[model samples]
Target: MARFEVPDGSTVQAYRFALDPTPVQARALASHAGAARFAHNHMLTLVKAVMDQRAAERSYGIAEEELTPALGWSLPALRKVWNQRKTFCAPWWPENSKEAYNTGLDSLARGLDAWSRSRHGLRSGKAVGFGRFKTARARRSVRFTTGTIRVEPDRHHVTLPRVGTIRTHESTRKLARRIEAGTARILSATVNQDSSGRWYCSFQTLVTAKTRPAHAPRSSQRIVGVDVGVRADGLLVVATPDGCEVARVPAPRSLSAAQRRLRMLQRRAARQHGPYDPVAQTKRRPSKRWRATQARIGKTHAHAAAVRRDVLHKATTSLAQQHQVVVVETLNVAGMRAKGGVRKRGLNRALADAAVAEVRRLLEYKSRWYGSELVAADRFYPSSKTCSGCGRRKPNLTLADRVFECDGCGVRIDRDLNAAINLARLGEPADAGEQGPAGSGPVAGRGATRETDPAKAGDAAGDEASTPHHHQVDQTGTASPQGEAA
Candidate 1:
C-alpha cells in the first residue's frame, strides 16, 4: 500500500473531543456504527466465499481463466457491490448516512491491500493476518468523509452527518479558532464509542503549522540523547553528549495507581453473570449488574490511559520544541512485552505502562514540526552497558545495578543517565535547514522495519506453527504471492 503523502507546508492532525448527545442522537449514532460493522462482515464473507470457490475450482482441474471471475478488492469495487446488494440484504439502509457504510468499506479495502502486499513481500512489517469478522463487542465507530461536518461557532457543539449538532464535553475553541483562521481544514470526522460507552468525535484535519525559525538553542551542546525505561523516578532521561543531565521525566504510573480499583471491579464482574457461561460452553446475555461493573472497569482504564497520554504528549512536545537534535535508541517494544502469560506480568505490565516506544514515535513527527532532527541509535547498540565515564564497556552490568561504576576512572553515576549520555554521543547536531541527517551511526528511516510479535519473536526457527498462513502454496501448485490464491 502506498503511504498517504501530505501536501507541502501542511500536516495531517486530529482533534478529538468528548460528545454529549441526546438519547435519540446517541441511539442514531450507535445504529450508524452498527451499519458500518454489518457492511464489513458482509463484504468479508463474500470475499472469502469467492476465494474458496476459486481454490475449489482449481483443484477440480479448471484452468486459471476458466475459474470464477476474481472480485476487485479496492474500496470503490467493494462499495459499488455493497450499494447493489444493500437493497436486498439490508432493507433498512436508508436510516443511516452513506458515509457510515463507506467507513467500513474503506477500512476493508485498506486491510485487504495491506495483506496482499505483505504476502507478496512488497510491505515491510509484521505479516498481515486475514481480516476477521467484527462482532457486537468490537469497537463502535464510523467515519464521515462527506456530508455536513462542522464545528459550531459556539465552540461547545459539533455536527456530523445524520447525527445533528451534539454538545461537546469540552470547548471546541482550539479547533474552531484554527478553522476560522484558515490554518486548519477538517478532512473527515469520526464518531467512536469507547469501552466505557462514552462517545467521542475526532476530526482529522490538514493543518498549516508554523515551524520555529532555525537558530542555535541556549544550550551549548546541541544534541541530546533520551533513554526510556520502567524506572519510577526516571521514566526517560535526556542528557547531552557532554554528560549534562538536562531532564528526567518521572513515570506517571497511572495503571499502578488504579490497579487496586481495577482488581476489585474485575473480581466483582467475575462473580456476577457475564456474557458467557463456562459450563454451557456458549455465549449468554450478560446481566445488568455485570454490564454496570464492566462500564466502571472501562472508565477506570480510560482515566488511566488519559493520564498517561497527557504526560507523554507534554514530554515529547517539550523535547521537540527545545532541543536541536534528539537521539533515541531503537527498541523492540513488541519483543519486550511478549511471553508474559501468567508469569513475568509485573515487568511486562510496567513496560507497557511506560510506553517507551511512544516517546520515539511522537518525537519522529514532532521533531519535524519544530524544525528539529530525530536520530535513532542502532537496535543492537548497548547504550546501558557502556559507561559514559572514559567510555568503558561494562559487560557484566545487570538490571539490579542501578548505578554504573566504571573501573577505568572509578566513576559512579546513575545507569539511566549513563545510557542517555552514550546515546547523545552517537551523533553531532544536524542543521535545522539541512535535508539530510548528520549521524555516522547506522541510520534507518521511519517504518524501515517492524518489530516481530512477542510470540513469534521467541518462536523456534523453522517452526511450522509460527509461520504465516499466506506462506502455504495455492491449489494451483505454484507460488501464490497473495493469500487469496491459497
Candidate 2:
C-alpha cells in the first residue's frame, strides 16, 4: 500500500481590502509596529546580555545552560517584556489583540534562532546578526501578518484584529463570489504597501479550486531550453528539436519609454541633490522646485516597475502553461559586468532590475498548479559554447556571434534560439551524470565535472563586495549569474 500524504488544499477563499485609515487608525498601526519592534529588540538585548554573561562565567566554570531558566532563547521571556510594555502603548491598541504581542515575540525568537545558528558556525554560508532597531525611515516599510482577519462587506470595510476597519482602494477580488457561495473562510489578511505607497491586502483564504486535467497527452510532453541575453530579439532564445529561434513577443513600449524618462529624472534628481551620505543618514530635501521633480522621479520608477511586472507575469504564465519541462542556462552576470566595456553598466543594471529569482519562484509554484517541471541548470553549465545539434563545444564563442554555427555538425541557427533548444533538450536530467530524455543527447559538462582545475571550472563567483549578483531567473528560467539578462 502506497501511503500518500493528504494535501492540505484549502476549501476557503480570501478577500483583500485596502485600508483607508483615519488619523487615529494610522496612529494605532504605528503603535502596533512599535510594539512588534520593541519585542524584537528586547529579545535581542537579552540574548546578547546572556551570551556576554556566559563568556564572563567561563572563568568560574559555569556552563551556559545554568542560565537557561533565566535568560534562555525562549519566547516566554520576550512575551514577559511585551506584557510589561503593553500598558505604555497607545489607547487605541485593541484589547482583543493581546495575543499579538506574544505572536510578535514568537516570530522574533524564531528569527533570532536562525540568526544565532547562522552566526555561530552551526549553519553554512555567511554569519547572521541581529538587525538594527527600525528607525522612522525604515518604519515606512509595510507590515504583514497571517492572523487577525475580519471582513464586513455591508459597510465596505475590513477590520484586522490589531488595526480595525480599514479602507480599501478596490473591492476584494473573488471574495464576493466565494462569500455568496459560502465556501470562503478568511483566516488572516496581510496588509502591504508597495514602493509607490499603494496599499494592498492579501487575504489568506481557504477556497476550493477545480483541478483541470492536462489537455496534452503525457507522452507528447515537449521540454525546452532557454538562454536569455540582452539582444534586439525579445532577449530570449528558445531551442527545440527541429531548430532554434528567438521567442517572439511584442516589445514593451511603455517600459522602454519609462526607462528613458527615468534617466532624465535621475539626472535632474542628481542635479538637485548632491551625492548620498551614509553617515548623515538623511536625504537632503532640495528646494521647493525639486519636490515636483522628486514626485515625477518616484512616479517614473514605479511606472517602470509596474510595466516590467505585467510583462513578466504574461511571459511566465505562458511558459508555465505550454510546457511539461523547462531548462535554462545560468550565465555569469557578475563576470560579464567586471569585464565592463561600453554599455556594460546599463546591461548590468537591467539584469538586476529584471528580478530573475522572483520569476523562477513564481514559476516553481505555478508549475505545481499545471503539473509542469522547471529545471535550473548548474551555474557552470556552458549552454552557449556547446552546439545543440552536435555534441562538440565551441571554445571561442563571442557575444557578437548572433548565430550559433557548429563546426562539427555544420548546423547554423539563431544563437539565442539554439541555446533555448539546448536547454529544452536537457529536459528531466541536468545533473552531470544523468542521461537526458531519450534522444536529447548528453547533458553539458559530462566528464569535466571535476572542480580541481580552476580553468575548467567555467566561471568563478565574484567577491561578494564587488558582485552585483541577483538571484532572479527571467520568465524563461534562464539565469544570468549576477541577475541581469535584458
Candidate 3:
C-alpha cells in the first residue's frame, strides 16, 4: 500500500493485493477486459469514419463551414454513440457492468483530446501519435469507478461490483482498519492481470491521515545533496555543503543479476509453438509448454522490477524524510543514451537498471508529502567538473577521470563525492561559492553556463543551454576568465 497526499484535506492512496481467483472468476475477468477493448475499438472506428468524411469533403473544394461537422470525442458523446450501436456491436454488453464500457470510452476521449492538443501546439513533449486499436494479447486492465468496492472484515478477501468475494494473497488489514475507522473512502478500484498470469486489484482511496509538522527541528536541520550513479564502489553518494560524506548505498543491479535466467526463459519460449502470428494478425491457442515458458519469463522480469522499485522507494523515502532541502543534478538520460558507441548497449542497460528518473519522481512527490524541499540544479551545472574545495572548473575533464584533483586548491577527492558536495552547496548562501579557492559563485542565471562558441558545448549541452554565454565552470571544473578566452 502507498499513500499520497491530496490537496482536498485527504490523502489519495492505493492499496494493491494479489488475487487468487477460481478458473471461472478468471474467465469472467477476461471477458470484462475484452469488452472494454471492444468498446474502445468501436468508438475509434466511428470517429475515424467521421474524420475521413470531413477530409474528403475538403478535397472536393467544399467550404470549411459548409462541411459536415465531425463526430464528438467527449466521453458523454462517445457513450451516447456507443449506446445507440451496442445492439449490433456487442449484444452481450449488459453482461458486464456499465463502468467497463465507460472505462474504454473515457480512455478514448482522453487520447483524442491529447492528440488534438498536441497537434495544435497546446500540449508539450513529443507529439502524440494517433490512438491505435487495443489488442487482446497485450496487457489487460480495467477500472471501475462506480462499483460496490469494499474490503471484507476478514482482511483476506475483497468484493468488487461484478466479481464477488475474491480472496487476496496477503492480508488487507491496513486498508481494512482505515476504512473501518472512517478515515478513508475508496474512490475507485482497478483490476489488472500481468503477463505472469497473476491477478491484482488496486483501490484508490481518499484517506485523512494525521499531518506532521512541516519543517524539521531547527537544531536538527540538515540539507544534503544526493548524487546518483553506477559506480564501482557505490550506486549513490550523499554529501553535505562542506564536502563531507554523509551516506552511501550500493546499487542492487537486480536486472543485471537476473539476465542469464531471463535469457534462458526467453529462448525456451521462442522455441515453443505459440498462437501469435504477426504477419497474419491472428493467434492460435498457445501450447502448454509455450505458456509455461512465457510465464516464467514474465515472472522473472516482474521480480527484477519489484526489487528495483523497492530499492528506489526506500532510498527516496529516507532522503525526503531526513533532509530539509535536497538538491540533485538534472540528468540528460535521453541524451546519454543517444550518444552511441562500443559500450552503448551496456551503458543503456546500466542506465535503465539505475532508474534515476524514477528516483527523482519519487523524491518529488515524497518530498511534498514529508514537507521537504527538493531543488534540481541546472542541467549543465558541471557539478562533477568543478572542485568542491576550490570552485575551479575543469574545461576538458574526460570521462576517464574518476578523482577530482583541484589545480587551484590542490585538494583530491572522489569524483562523485565532489559532485555531490557541489550540489549540496547549491542550496547554501550565494557567498558559499566565493569562499572556495577560485572565488567563484553559482551561476548568476538559470540553466548551464554556456561558452560563446556553441560548438564548444557539443550537442548534449548546446541543445538545452541558451546563450549569451557566461565564462564559468568548464568540463574540467577549471574556472575561466570573465572575458572570452583567446
Candidate 4:
C-alpha cells in the first residue's frame, strides 16, 4: 500500500512561482499595487481627520451626545464610502480592476481592527500603533480573490485576471497535476515583487492532500535529538540517547561568502546618481548604471537567502522523516543577538548564518507532514550542563568548555553530543522500560523533577498551578528549599 492516503478533509496551501513578464505587464501590475496603496492611505487619512475633529469638539465643551460620530473602519463600511468618493478621489479608477482597490481597503480594515484590539489589551505582543501610509518604492504587492486564475495545461504559463497569461520561470506541474485531478481549487492569487526585483505569483488553493499514519514503523522508531549551534566546523549536530552521532551538517555561510561582491556592487551604486541626494536637499532620478548595480546587489542577496533556505529545508525534512521523535531546544535567538560587542557581533553573524529559528519553524510543519513527533525542551533545561551518562548537574560550566566531564561518575563526552543525548532522553515516555541502572535517576522528566523539592513539596502543592515560580536545583541535584511565592 502507498504510505500516504488522502482523507475526506481538505487543507489550504499556497503555490508560489516566479513570473517572467514583459515591461508593459510589469507596469500594469505595479499600477494595480499602487492603486491599492492609494486607497489604503486615503481611508486612513479620513479616519484620522474624523478622530481629530471629534477630539476638538469635545475640548470646546460640546455636549457628549453632540460630538461628531466616529468613522467606521470595517471593510464593508470602508468600501461603501470609497465607492461614493472613488470617482472624485481616483480619476483613473477605470484603468485597474476592482480587486486592486478592494485589496487596499481590506488591508486597512484588518490593520485598524488590529490596532483597536491591541489598545484594548486583547492582542498579544507589543502595542500596535496606527497604520501608516505605504510608500511606493518600498515593496509592491496586490491580491486578487474574485479574478480568474488558472494554470495552463502545459504548466508553462499562468492566466491571471487583467494580467492575462504570463510565462513562469519554472514548471508548475505539481499544481497543474492536482488541479487536473480535481483535488485542488485555487481560491486567491497574490502578485508581488520581492526585494530582488523579481516578480512572483502565489495561489492559495484548497487541496486534498494524503496523510500517513502518525506513528513511525516499529523497527524504525528511533528517537533523535538535534542540537543547533555554530561550531568551528559545522552548523548542526544530531545524536541519539546513547550518545551516538546521527548526522552533522556543515553550514554553507552563504551570506558571508557573498558579502565581498555585494559590498563592491553597493559602493559602485552609491557613486552614481540615486533617487535622493541628502547633502543637496533635493531629489534626483537614479542613473541607469545605479539601477543596474542595485539590481545586481539585490540578486546577490536573494541568491544567498535561497541557498540558506534550501539547506534548512533539506536538513529538517531528513530529520523529520528518519526519526519518530525529534527533540530540540527552545532558543531565544533575539536575546542572544542583543548583547552587542565586537566579539558578540561575530557571534551574531554566526547565529544568523545557522538560522536556528528558521530550522525550528521548518521542522514543526515538516514533522507533521512526515508523521513525526517534535519535542521542545524547556528554555532553561540546562541540557548542556547536565551529564547524560550519570544525570549529574554542573552549576558552573562555561562556554569555553567544549567537552562535558562528569565529576559524579568521571564520564567525559563532547559537549554538543552530551546535550543532544540529554535532549533525546526527554522524548522517552515515562512508562518506557528502565533507562540503565536504578541509580541513573529519572530520564523522561528529569528537568521537571529537579523542580520538586521534598522539603517544600507540600507547600508548593497547595499553591495555584498558574502562579509563577522559579525552578532552581542545588548541588545535590534536588530542588532548592526556597521558592518564590507568587
Q: What RMSD, rounded to one decimal, does every model reach?
A: 7.5, 10.8, 12.2, 12.1
lDDT of 2: 0.54
lDDT of 1 by residue, 82-140 (tens): 98899999999999999989878877876787788787897897899888889998999
lDDT by residue for model 2 (4-75), tens: 221344322234455677888766665665555555666556556655655567657777455323343445
Find the candidate with the highest TM-score and give its number: 1
The C-alpha stretches of model 3 lying farther than 4 A from their native spots are: 1-8, 210-221, 276-285, 339-343, 429-486
Ranking by TM-score: 1, 3, 4, 2
On the 0 to 100 scale, the lDDT of residue 438 in model 4 is 21
Ranking by lDDT: 1, 4, 3, 2
lDDT on C-alpha atoms for all candidate structures: 0.78, 0.54, 0.71, 0.73
Error in Å for residue 71 of model 4: 1.9
Worst lDDT window (10 residues) for model 2? 456-465
Q: Write the per-residue lDDT of candidate 3 for residues 424-473, one digit (tens) a residue.
A: 77755422332222223542223322111211211111011111112112
lDDT of 1: 0.78
Which scores greater on lDDT, model 3 or model 4?
4
TM-score for predicted model 1 compared with the true structure: 0.88
